[model samples]
Target: MKTVFSPLHAGHSGNVELIAGAIVPAFEKPSRAEFIRARVESEKLGPILPPEIHDLAAARKVHASDYIDFLPTVWPLWEASGRSGSAIPFTWPTRGLRGDVRPNGIDALLGFYSFDGGATFVKGTWDAIKSSYDVALTAAALVKAGEPSAFALCRPPGHHAGAAFMGGYCFINNAAVAAQWFRDHGAGRVSILDVDYHHGNGTQEIFYRRGDVQVLNLHGDPMTEYPFFLGHADERGEGDGEGFNDNYPMPFGTGWDAWNASLEDACTRLSAYAPDVVVVSLGVDTFEKDPISQFKLKTGDYPRIGRRIARLGLPTLFVMEGGYAVEEIGINAVGVLTGFEDR
Candidate 1:
């Protein structure tokens, strides 16, 4: 598997998130991608390549144009507003609020465009976010060009970002952008299998009304997890996408046995769908040691997850998502790629 990476991710460092009712260092830090790249190198997984430059048009296919314009200017706007720290949103237009009105102020726009305060904007965040999107597109291009599989080592992981809102430490939904790229490039169907510990609410929302992409997510149940609004079992889909979305909301402390069972079922559905390509939102936060996530997956189990996906025998793209166990992230994330190749 070829790995797509970028040093620009380092620029997006020094950001923070609201965790446990306190401002803390962001778990989705630069070191997470560095460790994964180091492991890919040490394991001789494959050639590590810099991402190709892709125009914003590709991203605009999955994300709203207004949202895209807003992201790049967030830091400048915040700084112009006399803010000194990383830009974080504190208010939201919730239920009964005027969701249709656009707020002009940067502070109000931040909350208007985001579901939570997780996606903090730093001086280099826009560049890093674009680089991550480029990385994903580059890897997806490889698979579309006939490569069996490729790993996009994206940082500021993107599973939680929607078309118009950013949260869960994600800006642009990298996996969703790649999936849309595939469809636009002649793929008849694409399937996104998100193995992140948190539900891929963003991906699901993007494809909820479309039928070209099928989404499957396995994660901590929304009732007891972060982004506690979506990922329910009953959010099957709407309109043309009916019955195309699936969610396995595993409870806290879910072990490999139960998790793998869910994977099996998802794979079976993928087989039935017979998608032209598969995109795995490869998140290793399910690791027992992950600080912010709950699950019991061990490092050894990651390879098995990859092997099972390999059994599908379709071209695959592994887009990086959530995984904050900084020390073990490399082993767990690369284990999946290694297993797929070995299988």
Candidate 2:
């Protein structure tokens, strides 16, 4: 598998996020990508290439244009407001509040564009965000060009972002952008399988009203997990997408055997969907040692997940998502790729 990566991911480093009722350093740092890159080279899994530059045309397909316009303005607005450290939002308009109105104040605008404070920004954040988007597009292009599979090593992981709001350390939804790219280019049908520990609320929301792109996520149940809304068994799509969307929400202590059963069911549905291409939102946070997540998957189990996906016999694109256990991230994430190659 050829891997797409970028040095600009380093620019997204050193930001803080609001979690657990306190603000602290972000766990989604640049080192996570570096470790995975190193393993890809050490394992001699195909070439690692820099991404081709891309515009927001592909991203605009799934994300709102106003939300895309808000990201680049964050740092400038922060500096004008005389703020110093990472730009984090502290408030939100919930329930009966008027979210329709866009505010002029920097703090208010931040709250308006974001669901939570996790998608914090620093001066170099926009540059990093663009680079991650480029990485995803370039990798999708490879699969579209006839490669069996490719890896997009995206940072500031994107599963938590939605059409108009950013959260969960994600800015642009890379996997969603890539899935849309496939659909726009030439694909008759596309499917996204998000294996991230957290539910891919953003991806599901983007495709929930459309039947063309099938979105499936297997993650921690929303009742006890981060991004604690949606991701239930009953969220089956609304209109043309009614029976297309699927969610496998497992409890806190889920391990390999139980998780594999869910994957088996998802793959069976994926085969039935018969998409022209598959996009895997590969996140290793399900590993037992992952700090921010609560699944018990061991290093050896990742390959099994890959092998099962490989059995579906379709072109695949792996877009990196979450995995805060920096030390073991490479082994687990690459294990999936190697497992697929072995199959």
Candidate 3:
């Protein structure tokens, strides 16, 4: 598998995030990608290439233009508002509040565009955000050009971002963008399998009303996890997408036995769908040591996950997502790739 990466991800590092009612150092740091890249190198997984430049129009296909415009200007607007720290949202328009109105104040706009305060905007955030998008697209392009599989080492992981809102340390939904790029180019059907510990609420929402792309996710149940709103078994797609979206909401202490069972079921469904390509939102946070996630997957189990996906025998794209056990992230994430290659 050829891996696409970017050093620009180092630019979006934030100092703090509010977790468990207390501020702490951001877990989604640049080192996460570095470790994964280092492992890919040490393992001789494949060639590591820089991302190709893609037009902003490609991103607009999956994200709203207004949201895209708002992201790049966040830091400048925050600094202009006399803020000294990283730009974070404190208030959100919820329940009965008007969601359609766009506020002019930087503080209000931040909340308007974000679901939570986790995705901070630093001086280099925009550059990193765009680079991450480029990385995903470049890897997707490789698969489109006939490569069987590729890894997009995206940072500021994108599973939580939606078309109009940003959260969960994600700005643009890289996996969603790549899936859309595939459809727009030539693919008849594309399926996204998000294996992140957290539910891929963004990817599901992006494709919930469409039938061309199928979205399946396995994650911590929403009742007891971060992004604790969606990701239930009942969130079947609407309209043309009905019965196309699937979510396996595993409980907190889920082990590899239960998790792999869910993967087997999802792969069976993918076989039925027979998409032209598959996009795996590869997140190893399910590892037992992951700080913010719950699950009991071990390092040795990752390769099995890869081998199972490989059994499908379809072109695949592995886009990096969350995995905060920075020390072991590489072994677990790359284990999936190596397992697939071995298959």
Taken over the whole model, the C-alpha lDDT of each candidate is 0.94, 0.94, 0.93
**Which residue pairs show collisions in model 1?**
none
lDDT of 2 at 165: 90
- Candidate 3, residue 195: Cα displacement in angstroms equals 0.5
Cα deviation at 202, candidate 1, in Å, is 0.4
Give the per-residue lDDT of model 1 (tens digit) for 163-268.
9999999999999999999999999999999999999999999999988899999999999998899999999999999999999999999999999999999999
Model 2, TM vs. native: 0.99
- Higher-lDDT candidate of 1 and 3: 1
Q: What is the TM-score of each candidate against the true structure?
A: 0.99, 0.99, 0.99
Error of 2 at 294 (Å): 0.9
Stretches > 4 Å off in candidate 2: none
Tens digits of per-residue lDDT for model 3 on 178-206?
A: 99999999999999999999999999999
Candidate 3: give its CA RMSD in angstroms. Answer: 0.9
lDDT for each residue of candidate 2 in 295-331, tens digit (9 for 90 to 100): 9999999999899989989999999999999999999
Note the clash tally of each candidate. 0, 0, 0
